[model samples]
Target: MNKDQVKGVGEQIKGKVNETVGKATNNPGKELKGDLQQAAGKVQKAYGDAKEAAKDNAKHKAP
Candidate 1:
């Protein structure tokens, strides 16, 4: 996995924790921040996936 993939996964987990904590404590700001972080993580993860696919394709095409 690329750095983005790893970091994205980590951020997703952290976001989940923050979201839960925010909901439990009734903190809207934390909840919003968590939501944003989760979205960012998803994007980063997707980017990493695409990058890996491209790399794999390139390797396979090499003679």
Candidate 2:
């Protein structure tokens, strides 16, 4: 996993916590921020996955 992947996962976990807290406190701002962070994390994870796949393909193609 790249730095983005690690950071993404961390962000996602943080977001989940924030979301739960926001729900408990009835804070829409926190909830929305959490949702955004989760989405960003997903995107970063996807990007890292794609990059890894491409790297693997390149390695296999190299004689």
Candidate 3:
């Protein structure tokens, strides 16, 4: 996977941890922050996926 995909997955994992911890500790702010991080990660991963798809398309289309 590209750096963006890898980083996005990492961020998602980290966010999951934070979200779990926040729930355990009853911190709404932390939980919200984790939710945001997860959304960001998802976006990054999607972008990376699109990038790879475009790269592959270009390679296949080349003469």
Candidate 3 residue 50 Cα shift, in angstroms, is 0.6
Kindly indicate the candidate among 1 and 3 with the higher lDDT: 3
Per-residue CA lDDT of model 1 for 1-63, tens digit only, reads 899899888888888888888999999999988888898888889889999999999999999
TM-score for all predictions? Answer: 0.94, 0.92, 0.96
Model 3 segments more than 4 A misplaced: none
Q: What are the lDDT scores of the predictions, listed in order?
A: 0.89, 0.87, 0.90
Candidate 3: tens digits of C-alpha lDDT, residues 1-63: 799999898888888888988999999988988898899999999999999999999999999
Q: Give residue 26's lDDT in candidate 3 (0 to 100).
A: 100
TM-score of 2: 0.92
Ranking by TM-score: 3, 1, 2
C-alpha displacement of 31 in model 1, angstroms?
0.7
Best by TM-score: 3
Q: What is the C-alpha local distance difference test score of candidate 3?
A: 0.90
The lDDT-based order of candidates, best leading, equals: 3, 1, 2
Q: Ten residues in a row with the worst lDDT in model 1?
A: 9-18
Q: Taking the tens digit of each residue's C-alpha lDDT, what string does model 2 give over 1-63?
A: 788788888888988988888899999999988888888888888888888889899999999
